[model samples]
Target chain A: MTPPTDPFTAFAPALAGPPRLEPTDVSYVLEDTSLGRMLLAVRDDGRVLTTAFAPDAAHEQHWLERVAQRVSPRVLRHPRPTDAVRRALEDFLAGRARQVAVEPDLALLSDFQRLVLTGLAASVGYGRRTTYAALAQHLGRPRAARAVGTALAGNPLCVTLPCHRVLPAAGGVGGYAGGPAAKEALLALEARSAG
Target chain B: MSLPPFQQLVDDHWRDVARLAHGLAGPVHGDDVAQQAWTQALAAYPRLTHARNLRSWLLTITHRCAMDHHRTRGRTTAHEDPASLAQAPVEPPPQAPDDVLWQRVRALPERQRQAVVLRFVGDLDHRAVAAALATSPGMSRRLVSDALATLRLELTDPEDPR
Candidate 1:
């Protein structure tokens, strides 16, 4: 066979190369659930990073940017890292599994948010519900109920962290990142399973 | 076993991939070939169900990407500077430090060159080389031996009888 006259000319198209990506970049996967599309993002160390209920393209973009800002901006979509947590969340939402035994990386949250969310995860169980004021009191911040509400509002781990289990001290289910309908559905599912 | 993060794969094998790229596509195009392979790997990562050897999987992608680079370059005008193309290796030298031996290996027929590079530069076993080259393990072993034998003859002193 004739050796090519030159080696440089044939390979210039890819010479520009693909965009740079780090080996420790964050990765995510999107799963369709009854509530909406859920995005499960994971850190490079293989811990659960953040979960979001993306109702639309814009919602998905917003969560991606949020992760990009808080974590490494080198996020890419790959399912292997988040597969276990994704499966657990799926099972939990479908009432097939009672618990998601995965740990969310709390380092992404503010100190106050981390404190409240950690308290909630430890104190709450499936089919159980807590009032925002009750959770604040549990955290020894009886006067910080509204602050707890704010912290929970920005709950990055969402269902995995059991933020849906927090209701209003008033007589109704409070807001959820996945919307009120999803909140109610999750509560009802847990109630049926628990019963 | 579970697949680790894609980033982990990149971190683990990037240097090997770059070396293989240089061996296959020459120094000038090696980085480009490696980057293109990784970009394609990232795009297709989710669809891959089982990868018994991730290194082999990655090397296969790099080989195909480099080959694609060669084919595409065949169609384009050969206007790039030859002096630059033949410049000193951009990547660090492989285990075999003899530059003349490596150049001769590069000039070998494509299959022999690929088999030898996968065996040495990519540090893949015979089975892994077979997987990357899409050939039988026996064939990969034969190709590697043939390339090595030729290199031994070419590099040894022609007048000195061993």
Candidate 2:
């Protein structure tokens, strides 16, 4: 074989010589729900990272940057969703736990956001609903409805925070960070749970 | 709010990390060393306080992993010889240009070879190379220059100056 012109280019084969890192710290599991395909990432200790609506793998790839920024960059995929996480997600999605509140790990959240999240977690139940204005007022920041929206949008733990239960004050269901479709599904699911 | 580019970390650094491992432990244990380094690094990636160069951080991990492998082997499963690495199962064949080049890299003197590999293969800067090799930046630069000069004579790159 002729010696390569450039050493760096020539030595590229060694790139394949070593085993790669496969992180198992965080695991991803995809489930097809009534709304669409939902991709959920979880931690070893059963912390629900995010439940995004991913109609397909391409759709899921859109969240790579956000997922890394919000949850972790080293997340790994489990062969299947863990039983505990699956059960919790099923209960939440099915609206069986609507009257109850949820508390997911909020390590990535800010103090002010945590305060707002804690308030929402305490006040809103699965079957109940609140408006962003009401939530801001509840936190004594009546003029901060937009800020409340920003906080909810950045909520590290989505469904667990029940951000879906919050809506626009004027009457229509509000925007959900997961997607508008997911919000509609959750609201519809809750309406049934309420009855 | 500005976090490091986490998603691209492995995809960008894996090859460089592997090259460092192979350089340190030779072909046989190279894969193992790289694996351990990634596992360890990925486990601690979340709380990473800061790093000027992510590659250096990865090399630091790879270097430690190689050391651990050597420590565990104690003298039994010693690192492979450069001449013998041609028989490594991972690559195409010894006749392949890339394989030939790597074998030559393995033949370089210890410190010079490490400096060269860390500089080019691991894509580390002078300071990072020095940090990984536990030497001064000046020493790392000198070693790389000397090694590259030798490689130039042997491999004969027209683009590179002697």
Candidate 3:
């Protein structure tokens, strides 16, 4: 295809008129997490649509297309995937053992929550496990394990933050916002890849 | 108050959300922005007892959501190559009659292209376009004028009177 000298012209038709809104039977879920509230609209075909935050209460046409994107199938198929969760999945699936270097998309998160999520992202590793108690201790708050768990449960970016990897030191699976089944499935996937 | 009213709102504004989003980023990002707007609007519906215009409300939410997405993406160290902007798919290719004019419009600056889309394609008046872009009416007018001038220069020669 010959590149247009003016890139905007190629899409001018779509731009010329107000864009049309099409209706689809997609089921959407709203999740309020430690980071921020997110909208997860799922099409029947499993395309996942998510935004960083809620719109302001006053504005008409509050939603804009610039914020939306279709997540790749690999990320969407994972049992627990947030915008942050998907990045970890991408790295691990691409054969990276330690995704500590991966960063969470914190657009919706407050600074403290972003810091907690970042710490969780670094502390948790693939196929390995850490207890919420251990995590609290790691962050220098031995008594705040429950708070740490609450933070983990409220994490908007699920797998990317590796909340699933944080198990109970006593051998029970911990709570996951995407549900414990999702947590188990991710652990299994990591194990399979490891072996 | 009931589910159907909420459902009706979704049906009415879904595309507008997507379109506004597309203008902000492109189609791929538009879908995500629309989805987020729907979820946020629905959750806050109970608090909105006096909402006179649902469409505008939804569009506002969509724009905010898109901005949040931009802000979050900005914080990450990742950089998008300028070349990638060229790779975004064009939805409707122009037919022979308007193809040349369409090409000229596309060659305009990003701000001008956005102004044209808001005014012409979005069917938004100057005020609505201004609201969507968060610009003043005068500025919006200037954007449209600049875009039109560029298009006229490219599409029509001074010597030619069609």
Candidate 4:
């Protein structure tokens, strides 16, 4: 039988689920950065769960949903990002930080994607760049460069994993999760830092 | 295969689970029960072998959560004293001024209330209700029937006992 169309029953959908349901160990900070305002979720263990461009609540919600779909559904809120990830992001944007050392939640990635991201993030030097084909070749999947792009496109850890350094083999800057403009800005920042 | 996205699962079933939780945990503690249920459900989701009885699976988890909520909060359960049915609901009297009906519903035995809620409010059939409450289908049917008969007799004539 259909639920009764009573006032209380009608309001059922609007009632938020109770507290204690959300995973509290993972918290997110949405902050303004040189690239754009971004939402970043970090676990208590300090792993960066995901980073996505968010200029407003709608954008934050969009990225949060994707995070839930791909990484964790237990997202919660924190007043600030983890100190290390925060400092690294801030310093990098201001041209003072050397590395954005965030452990991407491998749970958010597939085996191949995890390996590809790990390889690129660890090996790609700052201020320099490499084609997806070259990076794939370096990782010993020489012919899997297109597949590497597919993996990078779904990268959860964004700039902290330094996926912006992976351009297309055609030489023009390739697609980025944070958009082409943010990608270019990051590369420029790294170049100026490198010199 | 991976489970459906957690957000999608919550969107689809929270209401049903909330109603069931509200019935088990009552108003004051129902929200807490619902939240804990979701937490446990999400953690156990990946291990769920199949989705054949997702509603019952969730309700079963919610049932345990509600029970735990009551225990941790030191609330009374019908198991404590079957005779204490007098501790019935006290809210919504002005709204459903004839809401003496809900109060009496609350006055039923604990198992009976659960059965009534699953049958009428949850709209679950005997088998699903049984799976939800971890009882046999036949017993679940009997519990609902007994509760309905009791309600019909006692509610129609508050002074009479059958």
lDDT of 1 by residue, A1-195 (tens): 112212211222222223365444688888887887888888888788777788787777777767766665556767777888878887887788888767678766899998998889889988899999999999999999999999998887888888999989777887888889999998999999998
Q: DockQ for all models, in order?
A: 0.04, 0.31, 0.06, 0.18
Model 3 chain B: which ten-residue window has the lowest total lDDT? B75-84
Question: Between the candidate structures 1 and 3, which one is better when assessed by TM-score?
Answer: 1
User: What is candidate 1's CAPRI-style docking category based on DockQ?
Assistant: incorrect
Winning candidate number (lDDT): 1
Which regions of candidate 2 deviate over 4 angstroms? A1-5, A14-43, A49-83, A94-103, A108-124, A133-150, B1-8, B42-49, B67-94, B152-162
Q: What is the interface RMSD of candidate 3, in Å?
A: 12.8
What is each candidate's fraction of native interface contacts (fnat)? 0.01, 0.35, 0.04, 0.11
Per residue, candidate 2 scores C-alpha lDDT tens digits across B45-150 of 8778765567789898898788778678662222244444456666633344565566666677868977887787677889988998899999999999998777
Q: Deviation in angstroms for B136 in model 1?
A: 53
For candidate 2, list the clashing residue pairs, or say none. A98-A126, A98-A127
lDDT of 2 at A139: 93
Tell me how far the alpha carbon of residue B121 in candidate 1 is from the true structure, in angstroms, after superposition.
Answer: 34
Candidate 3, residues A1-195, lDDT tens digits: the string is: 223233333333343222222323333344553333444434435333332234242211122121121221111112233334344344654556555233334543456556566777776666777887888888877898877777766554555566778888778686665556656776877788777
Give the range of the ten consecutive residues with the poorest summed lDDT in model 2 chain A. Answer: A14-23
Candidate 4 per-residue lDDT, tens place, A74-183, comes to 55566554666777778878887767755667766789988998898779978879999899899999999899999998776778777899888777788986789999
Candidate 4 clashing pairs, residues 3+ apart or interchain: B96-B99
For TM-score, the strongest prediction is: 2
Rank by lDDT (best first): 1, 4, 2, 3
Collision count for each candidate, in order: 1, 2, 36, 1
Q: Which regions of candidate 3 deviate over 4 angstroms? A: A1-103, B1-11, B14-52, B56-162
Residue B96 in model 4: lDDT: 41
